[model samples]
Target: MPRSHPNSVTIPVGVVVRRTPGVTRWAKYAWTVTDILPGAAPADWKVLRSEGDVTEYHAATLPLTLYVPDAEAYAHELQARIPSIYTVLRPNAESGGVPWSVALVTASPYEAQDYCDSAEELVEKLPMPHGLHALIVEFVDKHYEEEAFVKRRRKNARVDQTDDGIGDARIRQTTDVYRAPRRREVAN
Candidate 1:
């Protein structure tokens, strides 16, 4: 027999963090939906994955943002803690570092799709921190954004297309090209 769950929906999601100058790294703690908006839902966002033996844990982006005086230093710090992908849009004549934001984005594993949906819905239902909303909100923003992108594999296909939720559905039957972990790569 298959496993049973009361509420289940597929969603591809990740966490977004906003960094600002002079703000304490601890400012992320105040990012709770409550801190950002009154009457907002609780900050307890569950990631919906099994971490060891625990069924449920206080799962969220963990810390949404970390303010650093220097971008390169911050990048090094972030690269060390959670390595995924990162983008650094430097402040320039058009932009200033007096106020800047850093977004740390990551994909949640597929098995937690349902919980991902619920967590996303909760964030959407609540208002986000000012200015930070646009950057971070898009992660949970529905209607305009699809939880995951779906492409047509075939024009004459029977059921449109399905979203496997991990970047591309074509990966479902694809082979991963793996290179052995290197010590030098870790030193970086």
Candidate 2:
């Protein structure tokens, strides 16, 4: 991990993924990210362990950047039932390559949600390591500042002030004429 500036720390994180024999006839293997190794040496598809057909590979080493601006997001993740680090993987690897490629590693659930919404990449949530948890706590304590809650005062603005019904939906199932809204003619 390298402290690039006073506001951010960049740690080299290794993405470990496991491959298991697929249960279905259409799928050959089920690929999932298992764990992340902080301060890990750079690796690419390095076999870490094997038990029968289940194999774990250090697929890629990516830089996990922690910023002061994102401290609130980290705090939210840490406060979850299970603190997690999210990893995103892309399918359709080239020939001879693995079934998946490491697309991104993030600490923010908001960022993870963006990738999940795309539906083109696979997102995996791994338990946060204890060391990393401690490190993040320290970082959060040092950088995070809870913003003061300011309750928004409702302005006394009325939506039907002018009654511009140009875009109103005239078609409705109910035929009750009295239930329909009428534009009040404002006295000039």
Candidate 3:
């Protein structure tokens, strides 16, 4: 890695999803991400396990990237009872294919929140594996520098000394109907 971008690293991650019978009447089947594998090889809907009515598949291998700038967000997640990695899945609308595809994998909660705001994408949380957790902690320890809190001061300008934008400048006071004489009203 270059010195300019030493704080960033990518780790291969596999998304394992489970398919089950849909509870609703409109849908035939339901899908959900069950687990994540650290340093897993690339795969596409390869069956991992099957039990009764449920089946698990290795959907896709995505790169889980860690960045130094987002260390604070990662720290927040680490404080939780179970630190997790968020996966965003986009609906697949193309004919004759799986119902969903892996869109993004994010460690930062803020970034994951942005995806949640959109209606088109679905977000799933999976427990962070020990190996990935160590990598995140090591990366945070090496490059996570606590930024100092600096109080922002407003610009030094006299605001109460002027009426620059108080009223409508386009309408002259002498020609304004609100300020015009009542004689014009009586004459109408």
The Cα local distance difference test for each model comes to 0.30, 0.87, 0.84
Q: In model 2, which runs have C-alpha deviations exceeding 4 angstroms?
A: 1-6, 154-188
Candidate 2 whole-model C-alpha lDDT, 0 to 1: 0.87
Candidate 1 lDDT tens digits, 1-188: 13233322222223322222224775422222212221223233333344443332222232233221222332333234332222221122433322222222222222123334543222211223334434333323322222366774756755756644344454663433353445765554
How would you encode candidate 2's per-residue C-alpha lDDT over 86-172 as one tens digit per residue?
999998559465878897888888888889898789999999999888988898899999999998866986665665344444765
Please identify model 1 stretches exceeding 4 Å from their true place.
1-42, 45-53, 60-63, 66-68, 77-188
Ranking by TM-score: 2, 3, 1
Q: How many clashes in each structure?
A: 1, 0, 0
* RMSD (CA, angstroms), candidate 3: 5.6
- TM-score versus the correct structure, for each prediction: 0.17, 0.77, 0.77
At residue 63, what lDDT does model 1 achieve?
Answer: 26
Query: Which residue pairs overlap in candidate 2's backbone?
Result: none
Can you give the lDDT of residue 110 in candidate 1?
24
Instruction: State the lDDT of candidate 3 residue by residue for 1-188, as single tens digits.
Output: 22235758988999998999999999888999989998899998899999998999999999888877788888888878999999999998773558998888878888899999999998998888898899888877887677899998779966677554435667665454445356545554
